[model samples]
Structure formats: C-alpha cells, structure tokens
Target chain A: MSASAGSEQILHENTLYAEPVFHVGQFPITNSIISSWIVVLLVLVLAWSLRGKIKSVPRGLQNGLEMVFETFFGIFDSITGSRKRTLQFSPFVMAFFFFVLLNNWLGLFPGFGSIGQIVVEDGHKLFIPYLRGATADLNTTLALATIAVVVSHIAGVIAIGWWKYLNRFLNFKVLWEIPQKVIKEPTILLINPIKFFVGIIEIISELAKVASLSFRLFGNIFAGEVLLASMSAILAFGLPLPFMFLEVIVGLIQAIIFAILVLIYLHIATAAEEH
Target chain B: MESLVSIFHIDGKLFLAQLINFAIIFFVLYKFAFKPIAKIMQERTTTIEKSLDDAKAVAKKLAETGLEQTRVLNEAKKDALAIVEKANQAAEVNKQKLIEKTKLEVAAIMAGEKVKIAQEKEESLKEMKQEIAGLVILAVGKVIKEKMTDDKDKKLIAEIISR
Candidate 1:
C-alpha cells in the first residue's frame, strides 16, 4: 500500500500537465491564443457598434472614448512637443494601450486559467485549457517586442535616411584608423578583430532587445499568474482574494510598461541624429 | 549523469505563431482603428480652440463698445452743460439791456417835464408885468384927463369971448 502511494506521488509530479487546446500539427493552440482572438473580436465589435455615431455633441460611449483619447493625446503631445507628431503616431500607441489593457484585465476573470480538462495523447495526459492572458505567454511578448522594434526602425528609416540608420550598425568611420594603428601598434590588428566582432555584437544587442522586452513582460505576468495559482491551491478559501487583486494591478502595470516601452523605442528610433 | 529542467525555454513555433497574430492585428488596427478616429480627435481639438478664440474676440468687442459708450455719454453731458451755460449767458445780457432801456425812458420823461414847467413860468411872468403897467397907465390917464378937462373949460370960455 505504501508502494502504491509512492507511485501515485510520482504520477502527480511527472505528468507534464498542460492545458491541451487544439493542435494544428504539433503547433498547439493555447488558451492564451483564444483570449487574444476574443480580444480582437471584442475590439472589432466595439468599433463597429460605435461607428458613425460620432456627433458634434458627444453622447454615451463617444464621450467616454473622446475623453480617454484626449487625455492620452495630451500626454503624448507633451512628450513629442508637436501636435503633428502626436497625431501621426497616436494610433499605434493607442492600439497598444487598448489591446494590452484588455488582455491584462481579461486575465483577472474567474476561472481564466483554472477551468480546463485533461486530454490524453501518446500515453501522456495534458491539461487542456480554454483561456489564458496573452501577455503571460513568452511567445506573445516576444512577437510584440519584435513588431515594436522592427516598426520603430522602419519609422526611423522613413524619418532619417536609410544609410544613416545603416551606419549605426556598420560604423565605417573607424576604417580609416585601422591602418594607422596597424603600423604604430601591431597589436591593433588583434583589436581590429574585436572591433569587427563588436559590430556583430551590436546586431546581437538588437536581438537582445527582443529578448529583454519579451522576458520582462512575460516574467512579471507569468509570475503573477503562478503566485495567484499557488495562493489559491494553498488556501482554497479566502486568502487568495487579496493576492488576486494584487495580480490584477500587476497585470495592468505590466501591460502599460510594455506599451510605453514600445512608444519610447519608436520615439528614439525616429528622432533626428545630432550633429 | 543528471538532467535538470531549464526555467528559461524558448518555444520557437509558438513565437512564430504569435508573430503572425501580431502582424495581422497591427494591420487591421492601422486600417480600421487608427485613421478615422485620429482624424476626428484632431478636429475636436481644433473646434475647441476655435470656440475659445471666438469667445476672446467677443470679449474684446464688448470691452471696446463699453469704452465707446462711456465716451458718448461724456460728450452728451458736455453738450447739455454747454446749452445750459449759453441759455444763462443770454438771459444775463437780456436782463442788462432791459435795465438800461428802463433808465433811458425815465430820463426822457424827467427832461420833458422840466421844459413844460419852464414854459409855464415864463408865460406867468409876462402876464404879471403887463398887468402892473396897465395899472400905472390907468392912474396917469385919470389925473391928466381931470386937469385937461378944467383947463379946456377955461380956454373955451376965453375963446368964445374973443370970437
């Protein structure tokens, strides 16, 4: 009987339980995907419903939406210092704000991550689930970061010349000094390789931007989810409520940070090079 | 050999899937959400500023009108005072002329009365001298007539005796 009990303990730990959603040939659809799609649909429906309802005198959701836009525009205007710039980039920034805000808030719903079923595939039972917050997934954060960084560079290329942006990577001005250092200090040949390697390192740093932005957001949110999960599992009664509220606040803050970081990156990328 | 699970793991497929999802979202959002709404917000800002400018202009006009009204009121007050002063001056001149005319009429009446009195006194004096001369002549004539009548009676008696 003790052997059976020990085996059951091993079974519980080794199951590798995950919320098995639909699989498209090993690319499993997750609850987080479902939540993101739901957010997309909800945003679409909301925009459609409010379309053409705009008036000289605002009423209902129009007033509320205008107030929010006005507030954010004021903040962005302060940052950008030109109404034209604010207007130009406001759509991208506001989209980030709403999508992230909705995703974060929806994570707080009851049974978001909890409600799932166990499904068996290839002699293994995995926990299949319906809903998870998108930001909690590393994939989602990385993709968002990639889009932000890539789009910012695109904007920079459009703002400044492409050659200037390329120079930031290649740094060809040091080429003239290479011969001087080679003759005076023969050890400079070794240093030149380091400099060449440093250019590659610059490329890696750009890749690191993707990793840092993604991990920062994912770490905070995933940690919050785990904290709530553990709290609920330990107490099962009333102790989890405060932590639940705290997770809600954390989720919102993470979403805001992600969006604002993206905006900052865009601002930096698009700024004119100083002489 | 022992194997430990790594806490940091990258799911490449999941990342690709998310990248596709984000790309679609960004495109859809740019098309549907960004264009019209941003334009509307910009227009709203312009409208608010325009209203504020209109209010400022109206206030400036009101202030100007208030100043002009005060100027007109002061002008009307000056005109009224000028009219009153002119009327007072004319009344003073008329009163002086009336006093002078009254004095001249009194003087003319006094001169006319003095002339009449002098003419009456001269006539009365002439009448008194004529009366006195007439009385003296009457006395002389009475005495001479009585002496002549006696002498003529004596002479007539002598002439009758001579004839």
Candidate 2:
C-alpha cells in the first residue's frame, strides 16, 4: 500500500464501492463487473467442455460437475422435500452458488488488489484494481437477490394458482372467509384480521428476504477483501495466507448458504398451503 | 438513504449489467450443464433399477426352474420304483404259476405208477394161489397113498402151513 521508491505519498483506501476500471462508451465497467464477466466466460468454457465430454458414466471434469449437480440436488431435495420441485428449483439456485463462489474465490488472486492503474481522485492518487470480487460489490448481490425473490414469486404463481398466491400477500381469501365464519365462530373476526395483518407483514418480509440475502453475501465477501487488505498492509506474505484460506472457506460457505436460502424461498413460494 | 447510496455507489446500469451477467450464467448452466447432467444421473439411476429388477427376475426364475427340476426328478424316481415293483410282482406270479404247473404234472405221473403197481400185486397173488392149490392136491394124494393116519395128515398140514 506504500508508494514506489520516493514517489509522492498515495492514500490507498478499500472503497465500499466497486471501482470502474474502464469505460465502454457511456457504460463504465467496474472491477466487480470485469470479475463477473471472467466468471461468466470461465463458466461458459467449462460448460462447453463438460458438454463435449459428458458420458453416462462420468469421468474427469464431467464427473466433478455431476457430483456438484447431485449434491445440489440432494440439498435441494432436503429443502423442497419433493424431487419434482427440487429439480425445478435447483438449477437456478446452483447458478447463484457457482457465480458467487467463483467470484469470491477469484478475488483472492494476486492481481486483484495489487495490480492496477493509479489515478487522481479528489487530489489523492487512487489505485484502482482491474478486477474485484463480484459478490463483494452491493450491485451484484442486490441484483441476484432481486432475481431470486422475483423468480420465487413467479414459481409460486406457476405452482399454485395466481389467486391463491395473491392471498398469501393480501389475505383476500381469509377476508372472504371472515364474514361467513364470524357468525359461526365469533373468534374468527379477530383472528382473521390478525391473519390479514400477518399477510401484510409477509409482504414486508419478502423485501427483508432480498435485503438479508444481498447484504449477507456482500458483507462477508467485502469484509474478506478488507481483511485481506489489512493483513497485506501489516505483513503482506504470511499473514494474508491464513486469511486467504479463511476467505476461500468463507467463499464456499457463503455460496452454499446463498443457494440454500434461495432454495428455502423457492420451497416456501411453491408450497401448496400456508402451513 | 442518499448518503447510503453514495457510499455504496449503487448504480442502475451496474445492477442491470450484473443481472445480465447472471442471466447469461443461469441460461448456460441450466441449459448446457445442470439440466443434462441431472437428467443423465436420473437416467442412470433408472437403468440401475431396471438391471436390478432383471437380475431379481432371473434369480426368481432360476429358483423356480430348480424347484421344477427337483419335482420332475422326484416324480421320475417314484415312477421308476413303481415300474420295478410291478415287474417284481409279475415275476413272482409267473414263478408261482410255473411251480403249480410242475406240481400237477408230477402228481399225474405218480398216480399212474400207483395204479400199475396195484395191478401187478393183484396178478402175482392170483398166480401164487394156483401154485398153492396144486401143492395141496399133491399133498392129499401122498396122504392117501401113505395109508391114512390122522397124525400124518396133521403133520402134513402143519408143514404146508409152515412153508
């Protein structure tokens, strides 16, 4: 983090935002975006290779990929409790895991924070890395979270009827049940209102779900980046190695956590009833 | 809220770009990777199940065939024993009939020989009577010629009876 050989002092800060490494026309490509693009390319090439080499009896990379798929399916089966629904939801969820996991791991490479261009920002020489962790940035996590939630809702609508799915949020069916049941049971009137309010809270919880999903991943990865930066600042060699290993485990855990959470959401959304 | 946005530098274009990135990743993974692989795994599971079923069926048939073979073998042994028993019984009957026939033939020959012997005995007794008559006549003539005495006649009769 120090300047090179008697050059003027530079202030290096691990910014909360992903720094733009370049501009393509009006669109600025951030470091995290570049990292994600690399991840995408890697994933595509991997997919192509696996597609080429895939066999009924898997071998090599195809075998590894099959293991991942089978493990994801098992985790998904535990969550969804039905193979049909697990099959429906696991691919989308696994995509999130692979994306988050790869990005988080790629950030640990040497060039990520160290190799970059220096620019003057607010009159301080700023070191902008060309590639950062995609999940470490808020934008990527937020977008992924939003997609997961939106897709869950869509799955809910597709699984159950849209009318029933709507009642989960608005409690239209419960409100309709109130007038009929209030005469038979007086407690129904009070309980139904509470249930309606609970439905309203459920609406808020959906937003909370997105926030929690995005923030949890973003926080863990971004903190890892900052921790690695701090460790590098202290000693740069032996110190960062431990944290680097920790980040690797953290990266895999966070990815699995994100996927499981998405699967849980998918399960909840696609469930036949409120219970 | 504005300060928070500025701190994170949340950008719509960036969010859109990331979304776009995720979409492409999801598509490629779902289409080219996960879908096909999971399907193949499921197919593998199905194939294994089918093979297991076939093996079970073959084992069951083998057991059934073994049972059938045992049953047939037991029946054949029983039939063979029955045939041997029947042949033994027939031989015993044939042996009894032959013995009875031989016994009848021997009895017939013994009866004819007995009749012949009786006839011979009767003829011999007749011939001996004629000779005795002649001897008595000769003894009477001798007695007359010898000048008759009661004691002599008695002596002659005694001798003739003794002889």
Candidate 3:
C-alpha cells in the first residue's frame, strides 16, 4: 500500500481516556460528559413523553416500556427474593443499566469517533471528538458504582436499624456476644472471633465491590471502543460491522451485570441476619 | 496513581456531573414511569380478582336460588296433591250422606202410603158386612109374615150372623 496523503489527516486513533471538549472554570468538560448529558436528555424526554400516556391498559411505547420494566423487575425480584426490595432498588439499578447501555451503544454511531477536530499538542496532531462513550471513561462508571454501593448502605440502614446494619461491617455485637455465648455453647469463643474477623472482611469486601463494579464496566466498554477503533483502522467498512454488533451484545451484557450486581448488594444489605 | 490519573484523566467534576445525571434519571423514572405503571398494574390485578370473586358469588347465589325454587315447587306440588286427596275424601263422604238421606225419605213415603191403603180396606169391609145383615133381615121378615114365628129358626139365624 502506497502512502496516501489525503487519508493521513483524516486518520483518528482511539485514546485510553475521554478527551476534553471544553472547560467550565477549573472543571474540564470531557467528550464523555457531553455524551452522558445527551443520554440523560434522551431518558428524560422519553420519560416525560411517556408520563402522560401511561395507561392502565398499556399500548404502543407504554407496552414496550412496561415489558422491559417487567422483565427487568422479574430479574431483580429473583436476586432480591422480595418484590418490595426490588421496587426499592429498581429506580437506581434500572437507571444505571439504561444509562450505561445507551452510552455504550451510542458510541457505535457514525459520528462518535470519526468526526473530530485535529489539534497539535507537543508537535503531534491528536484527534478529539465532541462526544464519546460515557462508560468508556473511568469516572462515570466509578460514580455509578459509588452511588449504587452508597444507596445500598442507605437502604440497609432503613431496612434494619442503623446499628444493626453497621454491625455487618464493624461487628461489636458479635464481639460482645462472645462472653454471653461462651457459658451456653462453649464453642462460641472460637466461633465468635472468626465471625468478628469475617465482619472486618465484610468491610474490605464492600470496598472491593465498588472497585470491581466500576472497573468491570469501564474495562469492558473501553476495550470494546478500542477494539472497534482498531477494526475500523484495519478496514473501516466490512470488518468493523461484525465487531460493532458484538459490541452491542457486550454492551447489553455489561449493563445487565452492573445492574444485577447492584441489586444483589441492595438485597444483601437490606436482609436481616437471623443470628 | 499519578500516571493512572494522567492517563485516564479521571475528573471529579465529571464524576459529580454523571452522578447528578443518574440521580435525575432515577427520580424522574421512579416518579413518572415506574410508580404510576406499577400502581395501574396492581389496580388492574385487584379489579380482576374482585370481578372473579363477584362472579363466583353470583354463581353460588344462582345455585342456591335454583335449589330454593325446586324446594318451593315440590312443596306446592305436595300441597296440591294433599288438597286433591282431601277433596276426593269429602266428595265420597257427601255422596254417601246424600244416598242415606234419599233412602230415608223414600222409606217414610212408602210407610205412609201403606197405612192409608189398610185404613181404606178396613172401612170397605165393615160396609159390606152391614149390607149383608140388611138383606138377611128382609128375608126373615117375609118368612115371618108368611108363616107362624118359629123359635128354633130364629135362634139358628142369630147364630149364623154372630159366626
């Protein structure tokens, strides 16, 4: 292949992070933020338009949306084992799923990565677009994960009392029970400390949950974006099409995984321990 | 950590904005979409259940009414049968009484007619005996005028009349 002078300027490479589109004061508004705002607007408009048309006997878009809600609620119910808890957690979990999924799939559109401005930085030209996959950025996923975990704790505090919910992580109640249970069973002295250690492990696990939830979604989406970019770079026409389809499935899976995990966390947090 | 931050360009501002975006979606969806739809579905379920229950109740009532109707019809039939039987018994008694009354009237009328006939027969017999005596007297007188009075003949005539 000969060096084509015209194709060189149009060639855009995928970056590891979202490039900044503009800045508001000290805050740099990245391309991912713009994409997220667009998703938010889309969700809001859909919700608003459907708000008036929500009938008892659902029809058209209401029916489709209800089916989606029912299917997702059923999955949530399976995780939570209670419709009450599913209802409580569904708003955020569904929001996260739709938002992440939309952001992921929207990135595969025609103008997302291709159309951008070339700017010279350190004498090397870099292509920066006005929009990118919101979930491809670490911050968006981190924020979603943080919100999910935090909301689970809040739900826990409300479901069980505050002290009881806190005891899952810092179990002074278990430590205090050691003396009381020692006289009755005599094996609790050995079991109680291990239980206390598990509580500490529980705290560590909560943090791990946040990290894993954020990273898994971020890594998957980012990888898919990179893969699509690479494929497009290789052939740009027929080769990227199949990968784009694959990315859609991947995007849906990742969204479901994230939502289900959050639902599980909510279920666990709200459940009252028998002991 | 600095390399990771620089490479990924992790912005706290963007994270906050995304969080706000999510919060807006959550509230909006919960208020406008999920809540109303769920409420409507629940209401529809309750209404359907209520309708089913009402139908069941109506069916049960219909069955009960059917049983009642049969019971009432049976009672009416029994009453009608009893009335018919009573009427038949009364009619039989009335017929018997009418026959007895007619027999008594006929017997009284026949007894009166028989008594009247016997009286008339007695009167006629007495009159015939007197006529016979008158004829005997006339014959005896004639015989006396013709011949001298005989004691023996007069005694015999008296004996015949007495016998």
On lDDT, the leading prediction is: 2
lDDT (Cα, tens digit) per residue for candidate 2, span A48-159: 8877566788888878888888888787888788888888888899999999899889988888877888887776678888888888899999999999999999999999
RMSD of 3: 5.1
lDDT ranking of the models: 2, 3, 1
Global Cα RMSD, each model: 8.3, 4.4, 5.1
State the C-alpha lDDT per candidate. 0.72, 0.89, 0.85
Ranking by DockQ: 2, 3, 1
Candidate 3 lDDT by residue in tens digits, A1-275 = 23663345543677878888878889898888888888889888888898689788888877887788889888888888878877778877887888888988887788887677877676456789988988999989899999999999998999999999878878888899988788889998888889888989999999999999999999999898889888887898799888989999999999999989988888888888765
Cα lDDT tens digits, model 1, A111-146, are 677777666556554455567877777667767888
Q: What DockQ does candidate 2 have relative to the true complex?
A: 0.65
Kindly give the stretch of ten consecutive residues in candidate 3 chain A with the minimal lDDT sum.
A1-10
Instruction: Give TM-scores for every candidate, taking all chains together and pairing residue i with residue i.
Output: 0.78, 0.87, 0.80
- Which TM-score value belongs to model 2? 0.87
Better of 2 and 3 by lDDT: 2
Please, what are the lDDT tens digits per residue for candidate 2 over residues B55-102? 999999999999999999999999999999999999999999999999
